[model samples]
Target: MAHIVILGAGIGGMPMAYEMRALARAEDKITVISNNPKFHFVPSNPWVAVDWRKRDDIEIEIAPVLAKKKIDFIGVGAKRLHPEKNQVELDDGRTVDYDYLVIATGPKLAFDEIEGLGPKGHTQSICHVDHAVEAEKGWQDFVKNPGHVVVGAVQGASCYGPAYEYAMIMDTDLRKRKIRDKVPMTFVTAEPYIGHLGLGGVGDSKGLLESVMRDRHIKWICNAKTTKVEAGKMYVTEHNEDGTPKKEHVLDFKFSMMLPAFKGIDAVFGIEGLTNPRGFILIDPQQRNPKFKNIYAVGVCVAIPPVEATPVPTGAPKTGYMIESMVTATAHNIRDELDGKQPSTKATWNAVCLADFGDTGACFVALPQIPPRNVNWFSQGKWVHLAKIAFEKYFMRKMKAGTSEPLFEKMVMNALGIMKLKDK
Candidate 1:
């Protein structure tokens, strides 16, 4: 029996385990190795920071769900990956041998890159459930004595949606509390513009986001490189288009949340020919490492180059739907290989995301995720917020049921002509 091992059990890995279980032969053993037993829906972390969601609302005990599907689960996490021997060393002094390995360990939050940034420092974060919970307490403390607020992504950061979401969510919550006037908000970002979003602006995203921020009375500084952050203050250098320093600002803030750069987890870092210099797995179009054919990677663990050079460094985002496509392709490719056939499936890598703003939200669809796409659309409305809520509920249910893609989800994607894999 061919054993397929899936590493990590967060947004990308859990679905990958389910999809692999569905596609593999009945006798093929599928196992998932995760650092934690609970799976937290990462997109809802912004809500958790603002009290819209509790810890239990977004977390699922993944072991029970995987057990129902007849899949093995190990929560000891990965200590080291011996790709040369097709063996994984676990933290609990155990080893797993697999014919195929899917690495979806997600990104290691690089908070230490900036001094006084991240949950352990001056700013708070919504990148992880525990971090979001801590931010909730910080939020509580801040609202008691409202002052300046700072929110955005820093240099070398990739994921920008949550930064935008948290900023707007906090704005909405403060407005509801009638203390918005007491809080002056400033958005500091690494993107050259308000809505670059690392894909070079998806269809008027810049215009729409800038307009919304203006409506909310939120000021912004783009192409900003945060030099340092002390308690209650932030130092930033705003860069010009020519890469020159346009201005420097030292702003005081009562509360701050800045998304940091992401890198591959330490388990597989520094592996020659397997990962880029940043520790992200190097994958071809099929999501398989060129040097290690039996190894595949998806989600933030995969290396994607920036769309274009910017005054301040920024990388492209690998959103939820795009990661799902990668997972689907990886499973199918492994199944083909197990059947003594060459792997051929390739993911569409489409980008479809809903960025909630508490009261309203923005939705974008980039057909290929990169520039020069067939369909690039971004729009905002209250219905988008409602749709995000519905998605969270449906996705959680689907995970609990161990279903890769629910019938309704498939139907909706089909109706929209959104294909997860390229037609062969």
Candidate 2:
């Protein structure tokens, strides 16, 4: 029996496990290794930062769900990925052997890259639920005596949705707490504009998001590189579009959370040809590693060439939909690999987002994240917000319930309707 080991339990990992199970016979072992025993809905994490959602509100135990599918679920962190040896070392001194391996560990926050930019003791993050809880506590502490707040994404950062979502959620929450005016906020980011979003501003996103940020009275420092973060303050340098450094200074913040640039998780830090120089695994359009055909990567863990290299560096935003597509493709290809047949399909990149603006939201759909492609973006009212809320709830329930179907396929297609509307 062929053994399939999937690393991680995030968006890409969970779905892959179920898909592989469906492909293999009962004796073919399919096991999932993850650090998090309880899966937290990542997209909704921004809501948790501002106390809009509670810790228990968004978490579900992943073990039982995988077990129900007859897949072996191991709740242990992967320490080392020995791709050459065809084994993975767990944190508990155990090893797993596999004929096929799918790496979907998501990403590792490179907080230490900027000196003192992370939760050393006082700051908080919504990247994970634990971080969100800490951020909630920080917000509560700030509510007692609201002061200057700095919310933003750091330099070399790729994922932009969380930063945008967190900024608005904080604003909304502060308004709810009746202290919106008390906290002067600054959104600092590596992007040159309000909505560059790493895909270089998805179809007029710059103007629309800028207007939104302006309407909210949220001040911003763009093309800013975070140098260091201390208690209640963060250091930054504003750069020209040429990426040449110009001005630098420290901004005092009462409460702050900055999204860090991502690199591949530590487990596969130095696997030859498996990863690029920047720690992201190198994969073909099919999301399979060239040197290791049995190995595949999906989600933030894989590397995609940058659309443009600016003076201020920007990486592509691999959102939920992109990751979902990649994992789905991986699932199908693995199925083909096991059957000794050629893969029928390869995943391509498509960008779609329903970015929430707290009270309202915007929908962005693009054929290619880079230039030379079709694009459509539209902004609407509270209906968008409600739609987003419904989506979050539905996806949360569906993820916990363990969907065997490829759901994002429908989402990607439905988003195409809005894309058509944006053109009109």
Candidate 3:
């Protein structure tokens, strides 16, 4: 029996397991190793930070879930990967051998790079369930005495959606508490513009987001580079369009949240040719490693070039829907390879997202993955918010059941107008 070893149990890893099951033979065995026993819905993490949701409500035990599907599970952390030897070294000094390996170890937070920020001094983040839980506690303390609020991403950070999401959620929460007037809010990011979103502005995104933020009275600073963060204050310098220098100022905050830069998980980074200079995996168009035929990567773990050279420093975020597409494509290729068939190359990923603003939400859709052919559209309404909630429920339920249908996938793709078919 051929054994398949999968590392990490996040959005990218788990799906590959189910997809591989669909492709592999009865004699083949599937095993999953994750640092945590539970999987947390990362998108809902913003809600958890604002007390809108609880830890239990957003997470599930991965061991039970995977066991129900008959996949062997190892709830342990991966220490390193030996692609040449085809073995995964566990931190416990144990090893797991595999015929095929899927490296879905998602990005790790680089909080140490930034000074006086993160879990150490002040500033909150919605990066993980634990972080969100701790941030929620901080929010409770802030509500007792309303003060300054700053929400955005740090330089070189991808995953920008949550930063905007957190800002609006905080705005809404304060308004709900009738303390909006007590808090001075600001939106800061490394994106060059109000709506770049790492993929550049999707159709009407610039107008829609800019207009909405103005209406919400949320001050913003784009193309801004953060230097250091002191207690209750942050130092930042803005970059003019030409990458020239600009003066700096001290922005103080009583409560703040900033997304941290991400690096490849330590386990996979040790292997040669598996990652880029910044510590993210290097995968070809098919999301397969060029150096190791049996190894593949997807999700935030995969490396992509910076969208542009900005003095402030920034990188494109591979959104959730895009990551899902990568996993789906890899699953198909791996199954084909196991059957002694040639694998199809990975398809390019586009973006489909909903920006929930608490009272309402905004929708965005972009195509082609990269630039040259980009159309981003944004609209504000209560329905968008309701739609996002419905989608979240649908995803959790579907994941719990362990199946996502092809028909449903087609329907979603067509609805988003993201994928262009060759015509039936």
Candidate 4:
């Protein structure tokens, strides 16, 4: 009887548990370990910050849902990852042994890299639901006395989409409140250009996003290094293509939201041969650590290098579809190992993103997330925004239903000619 232990119950881990169950034997025990009891839709965090969504609207208690599928649950977070023994030390003074372990704990926000940079500091964040809620409070107080606003990703930040989303969402929200004119907005990012998005400008994204920002009247600073953030003031240096400082600015703002750089969670950090210097799990194409065959990883926890170098360093994004593909591939490979076969499945690493801009948005499809891709497309419209809303509802329902590959999702993706895995 094999016991499969999955750490983290977020977007990648939950579906991975369900998919493992679908592919595993009846006697194989499957368990999910998470720090939080509830599952929150991370994509809707920007809306929460703007008070367009309440906590309950985007979050659901996941224990009951996982229980319905006969999967054991542990809310106590992982204290240590003993890959050598194939056991996980839980925070509640317990250890769980596993025949196969999947780590999907996601990224640890690296806010300490810069002074006065995070929720506890001078700015607000929407990375977590709780942080977004706090940002909502900050938003409320700021709108009362509108001034300049700064929103973007800092140096070494990987998740650029949300920064873009929040900036546009706040703009849209302020316009609705009829006070947009009172507030000037500036976008500061680590990417060399407006739409590098860590995938090397997906289908003229540079041009499209620049045009969109111009239309929206939001100024921007790219290749920006945030030296420090003080109360109501941000010190920034914009770098030239040759990696030289070209411009410097000290911007003042009544409200700010800057996405922090990401590093691996502490549980697996410094694990020799198991992780990269940044502490992200080191996985081969099969999604299995080369040195630790029994261990696998998915989602933001995996190490993927930057597609190309930039003036200011940036990393590739592990998009929702790409992470889902990794989850599916890992589950299949674990099943293969159990059946006494060499692991073969590999995640496609495709990128499908729908970035909301309040009432309108941009959508992109990168066949392969790296450069020299086959199919790279980017488009924008209100329908994309509606699609994002539909996706949020659909995904929440999927988690509740414990359905990894829902029929409706397949149909929609098929209709759009999107492929999660490459054709064999």
Which tens-of-lDDT digit does each residue in 19-100 have in candidate 3? 7776678888999999998888888899899988899987778877777778888999998888889999998999999988
All candidates' lDDT scores? 0.91, 0.82, 0.80, 0.91
Error of 2 at 281 (Å): 1.0
Expressed as tens digits, the lDDT of each residue in 248-314 for candidate 4 is: 9999999999999999999999999999999999999999999999999999999999999999999
TM per prediction: 0.96, 0.96, 0.95, 0.97
Candidate 2: count the clashes.
Answer: 1
Could you tell me which residue pairs clash in candidate 2? 243-311
Where model 1 places Cα greater than 4 Å from the true spot, the runs are 406-424
- lDDT (0-100) at residue 283 of candidate 4? 94
Candidate 1 lowest-lDDT run of ten: 415-424
lDDT tens digits, residues 201-305, model 1?
998999999999999999999999999999999999999999899999999999999999998888999999999989999998889999999999989999989
Q: Whole-model lDDT, candidate 4? A: 0.91
Candidate 3 steric clashes: 5
Off by over 4 Å in 2: 418-424
Clashing pairs in 4: none
Q: What's the CA error at residue 32 for candidate 4, in Å?
A: 0.6
Worst 10 residues of 3 by lDDT: 415-424
Q: What is the TM-score ranking, best to worst?
A: 4, 1, 2, 3
1-424, model 2: which lDDT tens digit per residue? Answer: 8899999998788888877787677788999999989888787788887778887888889889888888888999999998888999999999999999999898898887888867764457778888888888877888899888888888888888788888887888778778898988899988888888888777678888888888888899999988877777788899987778889968998988888888888899878889987789998878889998789998888898777776677789887777778888888888788888876667767777776767887777767667777654545567567877888788777877777667666666766765567568
